[model samples]
Target: MRPISLLLILIGCLWSGGCQQTRLSFTQVETPKVPSFTAPTNAPTLAKKEFTPLAPPEVISLSDELSLHLLPGTPSKLVGIHLLAVSPDAPYENLDILHTALTQLSVKLANQRDLPCIEGLTIHPSIHGLRLSLKCPASALAQAVDILAQSWSSDAYGELELSRLKRQLALDKHIRAFNGSEIEEVWADKILGSAHPYNKALNNRELQQSLDKPQLLALLAQTKAQSQWHLLLEGVPQVDDSLREQLTASLSQLGAQQRQEERFVDTFSPYGKQLFVIDAPGTVQTQVRIGYHLPMGLADQEDSAFACEALSRWLGRSFSGRLYFDLREQRGLTYGIYGRCFNNPMARILKYYGATQQQHTGAFIRGILDHLKLAAEAPPSEAELAALKTSQFSQIALRQDDPGHRIEDYSQAIARQAGSDAMAARLKRWQTLTPEELQALAQAHFGQEPVIVIRGDLARIRPDLEEKLPEWQLKVTSVD
Candidate 1:
C-alpha cells in the first residue's frame, strides 16, 4: 500500500477502536535446560537512575528567535528533529493556509531526508502555529536540516507545491469519508463548548476560496516573520560544531513571515447543571462523551496539575481506574470506559467517553458524574492513592526507555501556553502534594462547569436521561 494510505489506516485503527488484547503464546517458549525459574529480586544495593524531566546539557542559540536543545547520549544512530513553532498569537486565523504550507514543506523535507518510515513528516497544528517533526540518520543530519532551512527560510512557495497540496487535501477528504469519524471534535465541542479558542475547526470551503498564490505566499511570509521556533534533540546530546554553524547561519538569514496578530482565550464555560442529547437515530447502542474545560490549575500551577493528574490516572487512564472498576468491571455497561485530560494555554478539559445500550445510557452517565464528584470531594483511600502513585511513577520510568514516548511527552509541555518550564515544574511536583491537598485541588476544578453529551436514539434514551437529571436542558441534533 502507499505510505499515506497505510498511515491513514493505522490512524483510523488507533483513534476509532480499542486495542486488541495480547494473547500470550506459551508455544513459542522453549523449556529451560534446568526446568527452573529464577527468583525475582528487589536488590537493595542496585542503584537505578530515576526519571526526571530531561534537561539539555546546553541550549545553543542559533538566532534570537531560535535555540537548539541537545539531549546528548543515545544508543541509536538516528537524529531526532523536533521543531516546535509556538505562536504567541491565538485564534490563528486561516489555518488552512498554514496547513497547506506545512504540507509543502513536509514534502520537500521528506524528499531530502529519504524518510525510511511510511510517514515522514508529522504536523500537529493547534490554535497556535504547529509542531513539525522528522527523524533521520545522524550522518545526513546537516543535509536534512539544510533542506528544511532552505524551504521556509524565504518566500519561495511555488505554484507546483500549491497544486500538490490541493490534490492531497481533496484526496484526503475522500479517503476519510470511507473511514470513521474524527471524533475528537465531537468530544471537544460537547465538553469545552464550540466557542473555545482552541476548538477552532478549519473550514475546507474557506480554505479553497483563499488558496490564491498571493495568499499562500503571504501565509508563508507571516509564518517566517511572526512564529517563534525551538529545537529539541533526542538520542544525541551535543551536536557537532559544524551542524551548529549551519543552523545559526540559516536562522540568522531566514524568512520574514510573522504570526497572526491576535491573541485570545475562550471564555465560554459549560454548566454541569445541563444535559445535552443528540440523536443519531439508527445506531443501536448510544455513544457517550462527557467533558468540561479542565481546571486552569493544570496549566499554571505545578502543585495543582500534579494533584489533578493523580486523580485523572486513578479515575480513567489505567485499567484499574474507577471508571473501569465501576462501569465495566461491575455493571458491565460497556467493554471499556476511557477518560483523559487535554491541556493547552487557552483551554484544558477533562473528557470521558464510552458506549452502551440506549436503555443503559442514563445510568452510566449519572454514575460517571457521581464518581467524578466523589473523586473531587475526598482523597482516595490509602490503597487507591498508593496505586495511583505507583502507576504514575512506573510510567515515568518506562517513558525514559522509549525515545518516541519521551519526545512526545516533552513535546506536550513545549507547545502549551506555558513556557518551556512546564515540564520542569511537573517533576517531583506530585511528591510534594499531601493527600488532602490533592483531593482539595481536584474538588476545586471538578466542581466548576461540566457538559454532558449523549449521541443516542433520543426517542428511546431521552426519557431515561431526563429521569436521571430532571431539570437539565437536553439539546438534540440530527446526526444525518
Candidate 2:
C-alpha cells in the first residue's frame, strides 16, 4: 500500500512540472516589436514649419479690401496685392464696378511718391480681383512694405478728393475700362464662343455705364466680414524669430474680408466645324491657329505624357523641332513655327501657330497636318530621343534657377491636385519611356481633327485655298 501511494505522488509531481514548463515556453516565445509595422511617430518632425501669421498693413472694415504679399529677395523685393470682396449672385454688369475700382487703385498706385523706388510696377486685373505687382531692389522691400502698409490703411485716402474724382472719372472711358489691346487674345477668342458667364472681359462702353456709387455701396454692404484673401510669400528671406514676429503683428492688422467667387462656364462650338478669319491687311505674313479639345487632365497611362512630350519636341517644340526644319529651313516658307497644348482642369486645347508667307498659307497648313501624321506613324529614333531628353532636362533645370520658379511650381502642383513630388517623378518616368511607348501615345492623341483659324487678308488666298481644303468651310470677316 505504501509503495503504491509513493508511485501516485511521483506521477502527480511530474504532471505539475510539465504544466509549469508549458507556461514557461509561451513566455519565452516573446511578442515581436514589429519595427516595420510600427506607426510613425516622427511625422511632426518631418512636417514643414508653419509660417508665423503676420498682421496686414491696416485693418479695413469695408468688405472689399486689398491684401498684400511681400517676398523679400537677395537684392530686390516683390509686392503683390489682391482686392477681395464677397458678392454671390452679383449681376454680370457689376464687373464694371470692379473694373473701375481697379483702375482707380492703379492710378493711385502709379502716382504714389514711393513709386520711384520701385524697379517696376505691373497692374493687371483678373476674374478674382485687381492685381498690383511691384518689384524693387531687395534692400528696399522692408521700406516698401512699410510705405505700402501705411498707404493701405484707412487714413491714407483723405476725404477731399474721393467724391470729386468719382464724378470726374465716372464717365471717363479709359479710367473705367480696359483697352481692347490690353486683353489677351485667347480671352477674346473664348468670348467669341459664348456670351454668358464665360464672357468676363470688359470693353470701354460697358465699363462706363455698368456700376454707379449706389450700386457699389449696396454691394459693399452685403459683403462678408471674414477674409477670402490668400497671401503667398515666396523667395523671401528667412526671418529671424524677432523679425518674423514683427511681420506677423503688422500683417494681422489687415482685417478679414470675404472674396467674391467667380464662376466660369465651358464654351463649345455648336457646329461640328467652324472657321473664323480675321483680316490683318498689311501684316507681312499670316498667323494660323488650329485648336482642339482634349482631356482636361493627364491620362493614367505613363507613356501617354511621354509620347506627347516627345512628339512636341520632334514636331514643333525644340530648336531643331520638325516644324522649324520642314517649314522654315527646308521650304523657307515661314519665319517661325510652333505648337502648344494648353491644359487646365476644365479644358485642353492644342494650337499650331506660325508666320508664313501669304502665298504658302495653304501649303503650310497641309505640311503641319502631314507632319502630325508622320509622328503618329513613326517612332522617334534613338538620336532624336536622346536630344529630346537632354533638351527637356536642361529646360527644367533652367526653370529652377529662379527661386520664384520653385514657389510657382509648388503652387501649381497643389492647384493641379498632383503630388509634391510630381516634378521629380515626371522626370524619372520620362527617362524610362521607350520609343515604342511614345509612338503609341502619338498614335492615340495626335491624329484627331483640329479646328482651324487664320488671320490674314482673306481676299488674297480664300477662293483658291478654299477649293483645296473642301472639308474646312471658311468665313472671312474684316478686322475693322
Candidate 3:
C-alpha cells in the first residue's frame, strides 16, 4: 500500500479505538530547583553635611515711592520677578478678564517687537489687584521690566478683545455649569457676605453686560492711574549701579501714579449650620467643601499661625491625613481629600474639600465630619506632631533655594501690610511652638458646625444626605 493509504488506515483505527496496543516513550526533564527567599538588606546612609541657614531678606528702598525685598542665596541665571498692583478702588467685576486680555496683548506686542524674553509672563488677579509673575535671563531683565510696565498701559481694549473675552467667559460658564466648579464663590458668599469685594457673584447675563468696550477701557485706565505697584526681585540681591538706574527709570512711571481712595468693609454675617446643595445636573461626581469661619485673621492672630498650620496639616495631609484615612483608604469613598486654611489678612477660614462619586457623597461628607469631631476631641500624638514639624522644617529648608516661594512669602507679608520680615518672624516663633498650644488651637477651632457646600445632581445625592445627615438643613441653589 502507499504511505498515504497506510496513514489513513492508522487514523481510522485510532478513531475507532482499534489500534491501542503500542506506546511511544521520551526522556523526562527535571523541574528547576526554586531559590530560597531572603529579606532586603538595610540601605546605606550618606554622610551628613553641616547645615547653613539662608540669610534673612534685605528690604531696600530703591526710591521714595518704591521698595525692593531681596533674599540671599546663590542666584540662578533665570530670575523670578513678582509684581503686585494694589488698587484701593471698588473691586472690578471683570478684572480677571482684563488680566487675560492684557496678557494676550502683551504677548502679541512682544512677538511683534521680537522680544522673546517675555515668553513665560503670567498675570493673576487677586483680591487686592493684579499679580504679574515672570522669569527671564538676567541679561534681559531691563527689557522684561519694560515689557511688563508697558503692558498695563497699552491700548489693548477694543471690540475684538471684548468679543473674544465674551466667548471665553461663555464657554467657561457652560463648563462650570456642568462641573459645578463655582463652590469657592459660594464659600466666599457664605463666609464673606455678598456685599464684600471678594464676593462678586455675577450671573452670566450680568457678566456679559459688564463687558462693554468703553467700560473695560476705563477700568484699565483707572487701574493704571490709581494702583500702587510693588516690585519683588528674586535672585537679584543687590543691583549694580547701571541696572539700578534702568530699574528706577522703568518703574518711576508706575510709582508716580496717584493712589486711589480706599473703600473696604470687613464685616461678615455668619451662616450658622447650613447645608447648601448646588444643583449641577448630569454630573456623576460631586464636589464637597466644609468650611469654618475662624475667630480672627493671620494679622490679628499671629500666635495661631503655626497652630493653624499644624492643625490643617494633621487633619488633611493627603495619604497620611485623618480624613483621607477614613474616607478613602478605609472606606474607598473618594479619590483624594484635603484640608486647607486660608489665612487672608482680614479673613481666616478653614476648609476641607474633596470629590466623590454620586453614590459615595453622603458617606464622604459624614466621614469628614466624624473625623473633624474626633480631631476636636483628641489631639495628634507626639509622633504625629514630630512628623509634621519635621515635614514643615524640610519644606522651609527647600524653599530657601526657591525664589518663587520666597517671593510668594514676601507677597503675602506685603498683602497683610506687614513688613517683609513678617514671615521670618512667624517661622522663628513656629520653631518653639509646643504641642499643647497646637492642641488648644485645634480644640478651639475644630468641630464647630461647619457650613457645608456640595455640588452634584441634587436629585440623586439629596436623598442620601437627608437620610444620613438629618441635622443639617438642606437648601438647593443654582449657579448665578
Against the true structure, whose TM-score is highest? 3
Ranking by TM-score: 3, 1, 2
Give the residue spans of candidate 2 off by over 4 A: 1-119, 123-198, 201-205, 208-237, 240-242, 249-274, 279-284, 297-313, 403-419, 477-480
How many residue pairs of model 1 clash at the backbone? 15
Global lDDT of each candidate: 0.63, 0.50, 0.67
lDDT of 1 by residue, 261-288 (tens): 5655456655656666666655677777
* Winner of 1 and 2 under TM-score: 1
Off by over 4 Å in 1: 1-53, 91-97, 104-119, 153-156, 159-164, 167-183, 240-242, 256-265, 295-300, 417-424, 478-480
lDDT: worst 10-residue window of model 3: 26-35
Candidate 3 or 1, higher lDDT:
3
Tens-place lDDT digits, model 3, residues 176-251: 6545568866766776666766566134357465677676676677666656677777777578888878877887
Q: What is the Cα-based TM-score of model 1?
A: 0.78
